[model samples]
Target: MTKRVFIIAAVSLYIISAYFSFYYFSTGSISGLTQKINLPLVKYKPPVDSKGNVIIDTSAPKTEECPLSGEMLTKAHKALWEKRRPLGVMIENSIDARPQSGLTSADIIYEAVAEGGITRFLAVFYCKDSDGYVGPVRSARVYFIDMLSEYGDFPLYAHVGGANCNRTTGSGCGNGAPADALGKIAKLKWVSYNDLNHIPYPVMWRDYDRLPNRATEHTVYSTTVKLWAYAGEKRKLSNVDDEGNEWNSQFDGWKFKDDESVNPSEAGKIDFIFWQGKSDYDVTWEYDSKGNSYKRLNGGTPHLNKNNDKQIEAKNVVIVFMAESTARDNYTEGSHLLYKTTGDGEAIIFQDGKAIKGRWRKKDVFTRIKFYDTRGSEVALNRGQVFIEILPKGNTVNY
Candidate 1:
């Protein structure tokens, strides 16, 4: 037994030495000394097209409309998407994790304050593939699960960890608190089915090389193609689950329309903040008339995707005002938050350089949230990326 222990220790030390040597050679410094020392090495590569070309061909005819964002794509892209379901990844927006990798690739994004005035994103990917890694992956929150449920039957959810309660003490969640995300996932029977929590290997990795000086919490990443493949092979979940039930059987996709011809000066800019004094998470969207899109700015700086180095732009920006409160469960140092998700709320829909005052409604967790203008008609979003921001009720949006 002593010999075996010594052998194991020796092998572990050798592996660690090799890892640091390689890191120093590639990055010119061992800045990860303070990062998570237990992180696994990055070994997976981004996916490539089988045809030896880019994922999307700009010259191809854009006939098929994506159900997620209503963006038109080639038949080839549509065919590829049909074989997979939506993937909701938990991406952090910490100041240290700026210029995230794959925000522009997501079809739809839901942003809300995770805790302590820091915002997080539940990026839903389906109609298109990410340019590369999709994170800086973070832990899950209960309200994010509520929003992700609208995707379909057994949507692939990827997160590192989550807010959990001490059921024995009845402190964090089980007694009455609704902020226990991990518990909720277990009750939903998504443990090994679709809830990819701390999944190792080809699903997720800690890429210290991506951002050398970042902390471990902000170094985790995963590619969309790898996530989909893992769901299919390991969880028996794809376009259909193990029982052969299609994912979209009860799905409710939002309505979409072409860009409406409108004057640019009508609603040229949008500004909002999640918390009172947290300027780092402040958001601004400037409308572009020619492109019919809104370019995003964070903390007064243009937010760009690290993968392609392009500014993050969206055709539609929907702001939903809901009641927010703290869980008071003491799940973590930051404390978890709870949001009223499955009810009616005031909303503002921005599209085609115009802002439409509207209301948002959702029947339940699985039901799709829809936006309706003051005239009581559904607001059709323009064809492109959709960004949904959930703000505290009574928070003001300046446009």
Candidate 2:
């Protein structure tokens, strides 16, 4: 009887494996399988107000424009954001960290290669609130720090760890290392003020259940509500800092406009890779006419947000080509990298199902990067989520 039962169990397992194998081979991808398996178990609940009301109400009229992305929002939404400073979270982009949460809620997302060919995101949140978790949180890099500087004075920066100096020798990535993010944070007086490095539990926690079998490195998760609450309650930071100054008093935000009606195009896709032959990190943005937005795909699969199982979409996709170089800090594992973040560079802005060949300029690290069209006029991006891709200067962007 025991032998007969074992044989039956083995046959059952084999049949299940064979079925999935056949599906994978036919589709050339397992994303369909992932969706089928994961969607059923989803019990996600969006955040709620004190009265148990859902914070995001799509039916409400959106009149207040977001200072970060110029996306209009309801008065209720603006009230919540008005009490908090801009929050920038470091989210990893490894294959294991797929279907990242809360990306669809970010006002602006900045993507760049963190190490080797693997990319990372600096998701900026201010005007909008995420309905669910925000990360598989990751370490920081110095360039992301510079990009976040444009948000406001001492915006909330959340990360696990960052490129820092050797604690004992104090030599590896100290004051002068280009990739010494912690060093820069300290120099800017943000060590304990607004920089959240490996925040305590409840604010940021590890969830092995979100994606089973994920390595420990990809389990750290946080939410905008928690981070903002921590910032306000623990760190004494909000829309106004401890010094009684507003966060966006000096912020030079980009211009925004409503979507433009355009003729349908036969081809409306943008594809590129951060590093050569790193196909898993390749990115594609497909323009959708009805939505007037560009849907994102990573590694040839729809990049869905785990919170709502919705594909990532953006109103504007800006590609900035900059010179990339290794920091040569000589850490034992591998040298860090640096990008030309503060300067003029060739850029391509995609909106209205079309491309605008342009240039980007940032006078300094604290200055907002602005895009200019071929005619030398500042381009007004569509009013919604803006995704900025920082690619190597020589990389080709196929559209």
Candidate 3:
């Protein structure tokens, strides 16, 4: 019991294990060795709820605030986006795909029609910035996968093929296999993208200065940063839905207006038409109220944003009449429209400049859609940016 007290306790446990290994490699953080590695560091602090907002904790710490846009986000967009998934994309609304490319940084845009009546754009991008240069990119539609399963953020579709076919002659418009809609979004394994396997390199491209002025099928294009770095190197991007489903990430009711001085109900102002006339899927919007915002026209003009010339504004458009159909493209004679973004509809909701017929309500196939008004309430919008439209019922609203 005494080799000089066991060599002075093994040289004081080797100088406290070399001073906690030089204090954890000179503070590469063990938070000062949490009581010398006793280890309990839990200080999360996220819970806010009673409308103060903050509550999404995907394990909290990438600088948060983007659980679908409570804004202020960027830690590489909360660590490489796709947190609660929702990316859709597929834009290309003819008239030579006019100035399109990340549709004014979409948070929601649907438009509809496609396959001849022209219009086509699903856009969506969860809480913003998918990387940019969003596209002339187009295709894949079965009602844009029922408007990405009625907007419960069920996305990750991205496109460059559908409504017929071409990925190097795997067929033609109305092509077979799982009966189109990009081969039923590649047989429901959903995580789609159609650069026909160019992999990590070309998500889709061909702008030879707008490729000899449009039509190699609107000069194929892509770039939400090479479509999420080629769907995260082919694991094929996910926040779920290869059957796993996941994505009720909940942004909750999206109401807003505790201050844009409460607008939405001029009952009908400046315009918002949606196929009453001037086709190309009629989309109008107008309503400036000195930038209380609306803008986007297309077919009556304006609607810019080829990445930046401006124009395409919005505070909310919505519309959603619902009830169109046609379906029949087993490869050509063209025409595969459909669009019923799921159950009940009528919803008007323009905003600031006014209009609010409202009623949309979608509750199933994964929730979150509500629009209400005609007294049933809900119609709260104004927090900025939304286009939706998706018309049907004999169209013709003109405001």
Candidate 4:
């Protein structure tokens, strides 16, 4: 019996030991199992160079090496390199101007070059006010012209302030007065200010190089200067000539003629008209006022409006229209009309301190609409000029 018991215990111990060994081997807890089974172990081999130095793999698979060190050029590194290239060009190679100011001649020249790509520019500065101090103020315009002339042979004209003297008029006193041969040169080619906003490449040349016949002639005179453009049914103030003549005319029925030859050069000359008298004269002209008269000096305001807080609202649709002249009247399509609207509400048009509506239409020229909620109901306000917004009714909101 003792011999049989000993034999049974020994067999049981052997079975338990085998089971534990199999579990550990299957779970990989027992290392070198594959070796013990005569299987090969996986090994990593890095690529080598001719000198036996490890060649870091920078290829798409990302073998090795730092991207900054150029061992491997990652997508992120390439992108960063491209982004910095333009900035380098600008920093290392840029034209420099003299006597820099918030609104400096250098700034004007640089801006023209940057925008138009024109290497040359003729900045014509003129005085719009005629009273107050004189002396240096009168000569400042001439001085600027002389300074600009030193750089290149650009057509420069100066304006002399008269009762009607203003920037738009391009009229000046003495040799620079309007109707004078010089004024005509200053008013040469009616280039729209908008077109000139961005300087074109080969900046020295105009779109067509349609140089004014009068610009070639160096003459000076004075006369009643007016911008011959037409304003459709919509009436709004614009910049004035040296004589304080604003370009606010009403065209009941005007259209552009098919004849393209009528002052085709005028298109490039009248870049665009800007309003100058909407704000205080001192702020716009940057000149000091003496009693009832004003004189220009080193400073003047370029913008016409000053009250930034003021806003224009539309009670109804408001339309604005413009044309080169009454004889050449035509409606410009795709012209934008700004307004605010709600899901359900009355529209109001606001401009120049007045809330107006039903005053503009397609037949009348340019039209804009302003939505209002007269029912005292809630309305959503989406504010934007070009992009239209349609919102569900809620509470009264300001756009």
Candidate 5:
């Protein structure tokens, strides 16, 4: 075997004979001499079994991204981000509609007080793999129109027809704030999934078992499979604006991290006072360190999703304080509350078990809203589901 030596100054391997000899001399006279060196030879060794049989591993590494959380995930868990379009289902959140269905599977849940201090939720699901029931579905509110607009490119909005009501016309005046909000958005030309039944696709139905015990209005529900199927058939899956101008244009979602950058305290008890009637509006969150998430409670008891028998959990809790206004609601026959959504406001974000005081700003309907701390640093959230609580000013959010 020849000895191999690598020369650093030039691109060549010098292989001397098995026996080496060295000589040092500097008598070279310049222009006429050149040397060509060879590289060292390497032996090849193939991987084989004990029997000298070649084996090729054909299994591919499984990897995917959860669109909602934007985190890399393995294929073992049912991915909700597989669908091309995000979906928003209007789920009722009254005393009657307790033990909600399919809430644990939502990516983001928006909660706001409806007509008479009763709150409602617009649960958004981008990863739509949940096949379970989604709601005791409710009618849309005026403000819900603006809230749902904060989601995907082409979002599927499923709700019953809604408008504000007057005390005179117990059937609802049809020209109140809720309907006015609906009309404003309709001018933007948003097509939706509703309970008109027999047009486009038929997906909304009532659970008879729930209807007997509760009001007929509170029994309407839909499933993820049904919504996906209906949306696909109705040609509502495309992200294009049929009328004119792009909707939800130029949006890059919030920043997320694998884990929180700051150390979180044991802020286990959370209080979300959504209304002046604290008796009816009381809500709380208890932290579970083992899961690194918060479990929801309504008035001191556990809040559960009846469909799957699971409590609502979130990695981030964002309470945005907005200016509130009142109007004559034709639907509820009382005062209609409208929360201004398109302005800069103070917000507090709870993540990694600690509460961070921040401010949120949204200039217009199309612009992306962001939360920043007092120093104007953008607040980063843990990569998971987030609950956006639209609390009015003077409301309490203690953790």
Candidate 6:
């Protein structure tokens, strides 16, 4: 009986030892595997995809209709103003380019105001394109103008450069004092071959110089004009462009001196405003000239010659608001990462005070934000503050 009892005890001890050995080995293996898989502790909700790749979420609440007229803003208009802000506003007499139709004769209006004590103006011109995307090519010119005129007398500066559509090999035009008749009206300070580099996508001076066509669209010119009220007192100011060109108080007026085509009736048709230390104006033409049926006064001439006779023949003027930044500073271009934290609720993003569409995960430890353009390619954000708000699920109050 004693031998049988001892045998049973030995078997029990062996079984317990074997079980502990297996448990320790399995536990150690699992620990090593966990270390190798070191993933982010925060749960990230990846963006949804369509066929094979990820797509940008642009279905958010956008300003579709024109803020003033209640008409739907077209894709082109949105694309232009989405990343630009006006230092001043100008309205010229012209026709609508979208519908390609003429309107009843009206006076051209220009208005300027001060923002944060800095004078700026908004210029609006009617455009008509007969064979372009829109009907008669009616369009507007929206951009920033220097406010140095307020300090003294500075000539109006325009930036005609390459479009962001193609970044590889594009440039701006440099039509300054020496080339154009500006020497008599204003002094050409500098000519640069680059676009204005603000936030988001800072325009690099070196890149501007590297552009191929320096005299064409790859260059920008700046000139200064002096306005003497009475005595020989001289008031000096500076006008600068993206290329770092400086204009002082010695520039002559419009260079197209030989073009003796001035209509008295058209004089009152164009209006002007001085705001933000800048001069903003618009000109409207009543009839097409004999030489050029399509050209009008105050219009952007394709070439430097006076033969084109491009005129500003617009009617209804709509002032579109320009954003404060460029494409590089406003959107996340190239490769970038955005992070956001959310409670057990919902989150929303707004650009220029409008909501962007997409689903956001709740209670996620950390979330990543990515941006892309209409073509599903990555984009860069320009300079300016974007509004971001986080709210609880089903709760109107933002967190």
Candidate 2 — which residues are off by over 4 angstroms?
A: 1-54, 167-171
Model 6: number of backbone collisions? 81
Which residue pairs in candidate 1 collide? none
Candidates in order, TM-scores: namely 0.85, 0.85, 0.30, 0.14, 0.75, 0.19
Per-residue CA lDDT of model 6 for 1-399, tens digit only, reads 999999999999999778766755655434434433334586323254575222323453444432211223344334432222111112112221111111111111222222221222222111101111100111112212221222112333222321122223221112111112122122224122111111111111112332233332222211110111100121122234333344322322111111234332332222222122222212122223332112122222221111122233321221211213112212122211111223222222222112223333323211222233334433222111111121112323211
lDDT of 2 by residue, 1-399 (tens): 999999999999999999989987766557756544333565335468798755677877888899888898887788788778899999999999998999999999999999888999999999877878999999999999999999879999999999877867655454367788888999989998899989989999999999889999999999998899899998889999998999989999999999988644833999998988899999999999999999999999999999999999999999999999988776666668889999899999999998999999999989999999988999999999999999999999998
lDDT of 1 at 86: 95
lDDT tens readout by residue for model 1, 145-169: 9999998888999999988887676
lDDT of 1 at 32: 50
Better candidate number, 2 or 6, judged by TM-score: 2
Question: Cα lDDT for residue 354, model 3?
Answer: 62
Looking at candidate 4, the ten consecutive residues that score lowest on lDDT are 85-94
RMSD of each: 21.5, 20.4, 19.1, 27.4, 10.8, 24.9
Supply candidate 5's per-residue lDDT for 348: 88
Worst 10 residues of 1 by lDDT: 39-48
Q: List the residue pairs that clash in candidate 3.
A: 164-173, 164-174, 173-331, 174-329, 174-331
State the lDDT at 215 in candidate 2. 96
TM-score of candidate 4 on Cα atoms, chains taken together: 0.14
Provide the global lDDT of candidate 5 against the true structure.
0.67
lDDT of 3: 0.63
lDDT tens per residue, model 3, 202-230: 66666758536666767667766555555
| Of candidates 4 and 2, the better by lDDT | 2
lDDT of 5 by residue, 245-327 (tens): 23335556888877654443657667877766656657888777777787888766888888767889988888899887775
Q: Give lDDT tens digits, candidate 4, residues 52-131.
A: 53343335353222211112233332322221100000000012211111111111111111111211122221111111
